[model samples]
Target: MAPTLRLLAAELARRCDQDGPHADGTGTGGVAEMERAALLPPGKLLRPLLFTESAAATGMRRADTLAAALGVERLHVGSLVHDDVIDGDTQRRGRPSVVARYGLPNAIVTGDALLIGAFREVAAHTPASVPDARRLAVVQTLAEAGVDLCRGQAMEDELRAQGDRDVDRYLRMISLKTGALFRASCLGGAQLAGAPAAAQHALTRYAEHLGRAFQMADDLLPHTSDTATSGKSALSDLRNARPTFPVLLCWHRTNEQGRAQLSALLAGTLPAETAMETLRVLLRESGALTQARAAARAEAAQAKAALDELPATEARAALHAVADLAVDRDR
Candidate 1:
């Protein structure tokens, strides 16, 4: 890890501890406690790190940025908890999922607590002691982004349920579900620093492209890696009947026989091993992995271009490193 990134992650992790509420009074206190512990592991911590690095690059003090960064990450973690429940997933980060460990109701409540707490943190720290309007604007932007994410997720669910196979539809789903948060993270960092509009907008573009690349990489990991490495079931997406970028690409490129194989996998009833094998075959035969890598390269190039507006500095370099890592990361 970069020195700056390590420092930022440590600071945000500390803030999360300080800002995150104890579960004792909540209905799902036990689950909340587990969630708390889960946050400190050696996972990517990508969103908070990105937010902090972006802010630092634009002259935001580490102290000034921590609360917002932590808040965003908390919101992200909350969403993942809720997502696991919705998808009926039983594991995350290689352990039993919140719902599996503490039942769905408690998991839901824990997620709600995180979201509410995130908003509160943003409200308390922004505006920088000026007129409160700017602070409110940040909150509003973040709130709307979260809502858009839910809408995007709903759209994806609907499409998959209806057996939609179009690549455009999948892109729309990823843009909203994944890209919104990325945009919000970048914008939030810039807003907190009172950065110029050009810098803010530049980071926004960088984040948007990086976000899509990140999701594409995430979507590709299952077929290329094992469950132990990915920290979740390798076949989970397949079992959930979700159509990822690679799968969508293969579906679009394959001939009739290959399409039939993919359709059989999508019947919402394949065994885990069979689904994994089908995905492997599709990726290999259709060259979907190659295409996915090329797409990621294009996005990474766009991300790098967006950084041209920022002053040359270690922090800017860190941001670029993150963009590169997003496309090349194994998990």
Candidate 2:
């Protein structure tokens, strides 16, 4: 891990590892325990890394962004908890999901706790060097991104239900669901450091593309990578009938006969094994996975290019490295 990331790991432990009493002065609720499982020694910690490196790129010390970084990580894990419940996913990061271990109600509460607690963490733990107004701005940025996350998830549900495959709609949904939060990570860091508008804009652009690239690679994992690497079941997207990047790309670019067959496969009209095999063949023959991979690389390149606006620094290089890491998940 990077030195800054090591520092972040320690900060996460110090802050997020606590187990306080529940309401009515009762003993610690298992919620705290569940939260610890979700957060401690976080996997990848990419959002936190983005926020901190963004601050670093703005000439702030790495340590100063710890609160901001952990806050985002908390929020990210909360979303994942809720996502596992919604998707009926039993596993996360090669372990049982919160819902799998704690049951649905407790998982729901755990997610809500972290989702709201993250905002509190930011509001209460901001560095003293940051002015009140910028602090408020960071909180506002996070709140708005949270709202966008909901909107995007709703949009994704609608698209899947209606079997809509417009490429632009898919792009817009991801920009909201995935890109908004990623953008917030960089924006929060820049805001904390009192960065000028131009620098903030550049980092925002970097994060936006990085998020898209990340989601694109994620969408491809079922098709291109092993189940162990993805930490999810095989052909998970197909199982869920999600209109992911490669799916929509194949839909848009395939011929009429292929579209008819693909639609049948996605509509769950075909036999399970047959649909999986035929769709896999369709995806390969259409080159949708290759196209999606190229698109992911393009977005990563755009994220790297956005760094040019910032002054050359180790922090900026770290930001570039993160952009590469986003797409590297597929490998």
Candidate 3:
């Protein structure tokens, strides 16, 4: 699994590098220097690689499979850049975020460029042997995912505006915001491989469960992991006022006095250190972390179960390993 995941990540990086045009050719004119400096170098590329492996497990030829995997990753990265701006984040992968380095407008354009570039890459590799309908379906699927991504963001914004989301509501919001892309990743991969409907459905289920577990782990990371280890701010989730699994869980389990403390923190008047301290106290006293961990474990099990529908193979084994990794990741 380690070797396969590494190879998948490397392949995704290679495709990302290949997809980029020269700096001058990237965004608008007169912005090439800034754009070049702000280029979001690829991250772990885990999603794309996993996606490609899923495709290969269904018998897609290696040469014909790379483009779709790269395309999927490009969409994921582009969304992240735009999402950072939306979330007012300043750092990513231990570096300045695109908006932080190049301003919001440029970051938006860069993300847009990545989106177009992804489609171009996908289109270029459509083998004549593959039906035109198949290519169109892939493109349409990606476009729909993009739309869902935007809808998810909008839903989060609505929740934030309300500012008093409960546990179930936050779960629903994050499920849409994060789970949609994971579903797309698996669905797209299976489609590219011409996998049977049953197989695709199983993979999609696996992705949704894994996505929920991944987000749960991510929500925990800000509180549990160090910045140096996580490659992002350790407390950004609280600082940004984003409702996470632990926060909601704590909100549910805490007594009135605890809720008052949390409410004060949410009111945005407390100092940063004090606010974080309050959050930590609420989480610890309410046993929210334990509950969140239990939920993640449950989701990871469900994700693994989804693989039961697939034929036993190295790829299936890797998928199960990934589920465990997602749930157990500390950073």
Candidate 4:
């Protein structure tokens, strides 16, 4: 990990430990304990890293910037906890999920507590140089992103129920579900730094593209990587009857027979393992996998292009590397 990422992780762990209701020793202790476990290992730390690097690129590095980074990460972890409960996922990052370790109620409460803790962490931020109004803007950015995330998730559920396969719709859903937070991370970092509006807009666009690429790559994982490599169950999306990028691309490109197979698989009429194999073969043979990969690469390219507006700095270079990692990683 980069030094900045390490710093962000350490600070995030410290914030998680120090804030919230942990001191009460009541049931809140359980929430705090779960928060530490969920956040401390700090999978990727991409959101915080994005925020920190964005701040650095804008020539602003403060304790409050780190706090804002932690705030985005907390929101992310809370989303994951709630997602696990909704998806009935028993595992995350190769360990039992919060819902699996504790009961559903605990997982839900823990997720809510994390969100509250995120606000508390942000509220406590008082950068000596930054004004209170700017700090409040950061908080508002987070709040709006949270709303977008919930709207995205709800839209996704509705789409899944309708068996929607439109690529445009899928992109819009992911823009909200995944891209919103990425946007917030970059925007909040810039806001904390009191960056000019143009720079902030550029970073926001960069984050949007990066987030789309990140999710596109994630949608490919079930078919391209195994459980150990991906840190997720193989064909888990298929089992849940969710339509991902590769699946939708395959649907668009394949023959009528292939479409029937996909429909059966998605409708739960076909056996899951058999459907998974059939879809994988269809995706690979029909050029959907290549197309999906191309789409991810295109998005990453656009993300990098958005950075052209920023000053050339090591922090900007770090952001470039993050865009690469967004699509290149297996997990």
**Best candidate per TM-score, number?**
4
Which ranges of candidate 4 are over 4 A from the true structure? 19-28, 62-64
Q: Mark the regions of model 2 whose C-alpha exceeds 4 Å error after superposition.
A: 22-29, 270-274
Per-residue lDDT over 1-331 for candidate 4, one digit per residue giving the tens place of the 0 to 100 score: 2888878878877766665653455644566788777786888889988988888889886445787788888999999999989988888888888999998999998899888777766778646567888888989999999999999999888889999989999999999999999999999989888899999999999999999999999999988788887777775688788879999999999999989888898988878788888888999999999999999999999999999999999999999999998888889
Per-residue CA lDDT of model 2 for 1-331, tens digit only, reads: 3988898888888875454675677436577888887786478888989999998899888887898788898888999999989888888887788999999999999999888987887888877877889889889999999999999999999999998989999999999999988999999999988899999999999988999999999988877777687777665577678889988898878899989998888788877677878987888999998999899999999999999999999999888888788887743
Native-to-model Cα distance after best TM-score fit, residue 239 in candidate 4, in Å: 1.6
lDDT of 3 by residue, 1-331 (tens): 5665566556655644454456557533434333334443556566776677677667776456667767777788778878888778888888888889889888888788767766775677756676666666677777887887788788777776688557777777767788877887777777877889999889989988998899998899877877778878765666667778888888889889988887778767798777887788789889999999999989999999999999888878878888998878766
**Superposition error at 81 for model 4 (Å):** 0.3
Q: Once model 2 is optimally superposed onto the true structure by TM-score, how far is the C-alpha of residue 162 displaced, in angstroms?
A: 1.2
Which ten residues in a row are the worst by lDDT in model 1? 20-29
Model 3 misplaced stretches (Cα beyond 4 Å)? 2-41, 126-128
Q: What overall lDDT goes with each candidate model?
A: 0.80, 0.87, 0.76, 0.87
lDDT for model 4 comes to 0.87
For every model shown, what is its TM-score relative to the native structure? Answer: 0.92, 0.95, 0.91, 0.96
Considering only N, C-alpha and C atoms within 3 Å, which residue pairs clash in candidate 3? none
Candidate 1 per-residue lDDT over residues 94-189, each given as its tens digit = 888878988988889778877777787788864365246646666776897799889988998998898898888888888899988888888887
> Whose TM-score is higher: candidate 1's or candidate 4's?
4
